[model samples]
Target: MSVDVPRRIVIFRHAKADWSQESDHERPLAERGRRDAPAAGRWLASAGIAPELTLCSSAVRTRETWKLAVHELPQRPRTVYEDRMYEASLGELIALVNETAEDVNELLLVGHNPGMHALADALAGDAEGDALARMNRAGFPTAAIAVLTFQGTWKSVEHGVGRLTAYWSPQE
Candidate 1:
């Protein structure tokens, strides 16, 4: 894609996780999560928000969520399960996003919060409709996604450089 082309980023929080697992990384999704994840995917598909690349946390919950959600998409994108994203901070997440290849115009991040939530808020210098307010009011709950649009190369992605174009959640 050209440097001037608009790029989209969907920051997604993994679905609700089962707390019974002793290891956090190995925790699977709860029943509600399974239900919500597919809904999130259908919403993405219906909204025509397909990413060219997907960066997912290496946690079991995230993996499971992606497995369910991706099946609803018309096409599958390149997906990477990154270990560092399990508990990444906002800065760390931004750095990871900056490393995205310039050719990929749309990127998806399936991870945790408050990093996902913080990234959405930080990148969005402005918002459309009541997306910002809804996101804030919802507190970025599980299976939630924030859609941001920005211009320039991935390396230039930074705070206040994007517009929050949309926000969605299972409850909504």
Candidate 2:
């Protein structure tokens, strides 16, 4: 099979939601989350990590978080809303990534966790000791970004096949 290696896949969980809201999926980002989203975006921009495509969950919080982050991106990428990403499982998330258009070299997925956290752990290979330990200590926080590299095409991305390039959390 021809390998269509994706240089990087950045997964971001929506920022913290207002718990006082009734509907979990509809909850908007909390005040703290709003502030942190831009900070995280700045970090990505400063690092020269820009995505070619953005796949975001349809949930309000996730959408809002994506909006905040995209502002800091050096260039705006094409975006698509995927409802399945709202509460997807690790396997489902992988499938979504694999389904991305082949021409897109870098992809960003903005969704929720523990699916995001689980996917990170499942795909990461040879992660830095400090990063692995930190990921294990705390499930990915809202507004956290996990950068993973895959050797083969996005269509062939499988569990345990990616290297953790970097991880960024708001608290860090």
Candidate 3:
């Protein structure tokens, strides 16, 4: 990959889950989440942010969200469901990104919060405008998406090197 090429990482928080289930991993998406996931996917597709690869958490809610969302994409990306991503730490997520193949430029990660939120905050050094400001005001919520762009290969992707191009939530 050329140094001039920019890699984009799209981080997505899984949609609202059905809390009636006892197992965290087993919990499925709520009724609202089922409807919202496709909207987020369409938004990304319409914005020309189609990913070349998707890393999804093994949790039921995350898996279901990915299932519903990809239908709205312009193209189907290679996807993997991993158990580690269910509640991965920022470092773990960074490591995963670093390990991405050089050819893959746009990567979408569907996982849970706290780690995803921290990862976005750590990687994004600068913001365009109200995207970062709004995130600071409301915080990352269900079905929210954060887009980070940086001029480098996946191997070079690092903390505080990304530019937060956009942030969106289903509530909006």
- Residue pairs clashing in model 3 are none
Model 3 residue 39 CA deviation in Å: 1.0
For candidate 2, give the lDDT of residue 98. Answer: 85
lDDT of 1 by residue, 1-172 (tens): 5678899999999999999836988999999999999999999999898899999999999999999999999999999999989999999999999999988999999999899999999999999999999999999999999999999999999999999999999988
Per-residue lDDT for 147 in model 3? Answer: 96
Order the candidate numbers by TM-score, best to worst: 1, 3, 2
**Residue 163 of model 3: what lDDT?**
95
Best by lDDT: 1
Q: In angstroms, how far off is 111's CA in candidate 3? A: 0.3
| Model 3 weakest lDDT span, ten residues long | 130-139
Ten contiguous residues minimizing lDDT sum, candidate 1? 16-25
Best by TM-score: 1
Q: Compared with the true structure, what per-residue lDDT tens digits does model 3 show for residues 1-172? A: 5887888999999988988746998999999999999999998888788899999999999999999999999799999998889789999999988989988889999999998888888998998888888776668889999999999888787889899999989887
User: Distance (Å) between predicted and true CA of 29, model 1?
Assistant: 0.2
